[model samples]
Target: MQNLTTKLLAAAALVAVAGCAKKAPEQLPPPPPTETTPAPETSQPTGPVGSTVVPGSKEDFLQQVGSDRVLFATDQYDLSGEARATLDSQAAWLAKYPNVRITIEGHADERGTREYNLALGDRRANSAKNYLATKIDAGRISTVSYGKERPEVAGSDEGAWAQNRRAVTVVITGM
Candidate 1:
């Protein structure tokens, strides 16, 4: 009689548990789509007369100035006529944006020793910086020589060396 009572109690507990179990939630309908306006074009040139779009912007400077770098003659830190012209344009652009600060990176070909190349690169960077100082504030510019450590082109050929020996103007901030 005790076993029969125990079985009945166990069956009642199971029935209660089954009855208390949660049911699955009903599915919700998908949200309706909404219309969106087309985004404005950013690549178009829309600046002052004879100037590129967004004068103080980096993209405008790159497009108007042709390149941010100037190549140097072998073993020389002097600015060539072409380099001077490029820097002239750069100076104009920098003048237009007084808030811009820059770093001049000096580089050299792979022919020289690491220490020698580093020194050469420093001279190259300083040369460019000095020229730019006449145009922009000296305080806004800094210099660093990568030497032969970072070459624009690899290998020891004249072609690669020509590309490697260069000073590059990089916009640091406020542009």
Candidate 2:
């Protein structure tokens, strides 16, 4: 009888405690999509000249320039030869569309302190911006550093890290 009463009291207490817990809303929103397209292994321009690329559009930039991003070495913000080539293509494309404005987003791998990564990302962004500024008007290009907060690939492995460490030029205006 005593054990039964103790069990009942415990059960009642548990029920009371559970009742106080905030109930989740019945209609929770769906989670946001996370799928992302991987960048191509090569940066060579693949779009046919005078192709059906919409002028001053993001799609046009990607199709015309082959890549809007340039990968960087770990802990290094300097543009690689391949990166420069890609940037050169980008510059040529930009020259064709003088009304376009771009924002270079700098990203870092998920391997450093937030503050350090932010600074590194900033340097990477500036590197791309400076390179582009030489050909395009300095006022037409802007930069932003996402640091490690935005990873191109979600993993702790080297391959993922390599992809995440990059500066991506985004066509923000003149679309």
Candidate 3:
């Protein structure tokens, strides 16, 4: 009698446990489709031969020239052959737009003390600025050094460092 009572209780508990099991949730309705508006079309304006459509504009300068900056070798302030070529093109662009003013920003890789790197970057910027002065009015260009504060790429590797060491010619006004 005792064994039968225990068995009955066990069966009742099993049924109770089974009843508490979870059931699948009902499915929700799908979301409605979203409507999007078409973007306005923008075209690049054409300019006369040897002139930019938007003279002194950063976009025009970058488009007409290969790049707005010249990369430097590690820890070096001297301009390389390629750097010279790029600066030469930048000078010609500056010459074409006589009213344009530029700021030469010098940057250094993250391998030196803040003070040292700042000085190095200053030298780099001045190097580029001095070179550009030969082609355009010296008064049209200014120089600033960011040291390692603003890096083009973020990494400790040589590839990233190489990119960080650069002098960028930025159009400040007259665009």
- What is the Cα root-mean-square deviation between model 2 and the actual structure? 11.2
Which residue ranges in model 1 land beyond 4 Å of their true spot? Answer: 1-54
- Name the lDDT value of residue 123 in candidate 3: 96
Query: How close is every model to the real structure, measured as TM-score?
Result: 0.68, 0.69, 0.69
User: What would the TM-score be for candidate 2 when compared with the true structure?
Assistant: 0.69
lDDT by residue for model 1 (1-175), tens: 9999999999999999999998886976876543222123334453566764454556656766768999999999999999988899899877766776778999999986999999999999999999999988999899999999998988879999999999999876332
Those runs of model 3 whose alpha carbons end farther than 4 Å from true positions after fitting are 1-53
Can you write out model 2's per-residue Cα lDDT over 1-175, one digit (the tens) per residue? 9999999999999999999999889999997654223233233344576565446667767867869999999999998999999999999888876767789999999998999999999999999999989988989898999999999999989999999999999987432
* Comparing 1 and 2 on TM-score, the stronger one: 2
lDDT of 2 at 132: 89
lDDT string, candidate 3, 1-175, tens digits: 9999999999999999999998886987887643222112234353566664454467667877878999889889999999999999998777767766789999999999999999989999999999999889999899999999999999999999999999999976432
Stretches of candidate 2 exceeding 4 Å from the true structure? 1-53
- When 2 and 3 are scored with lDDT, the better candidate is 2
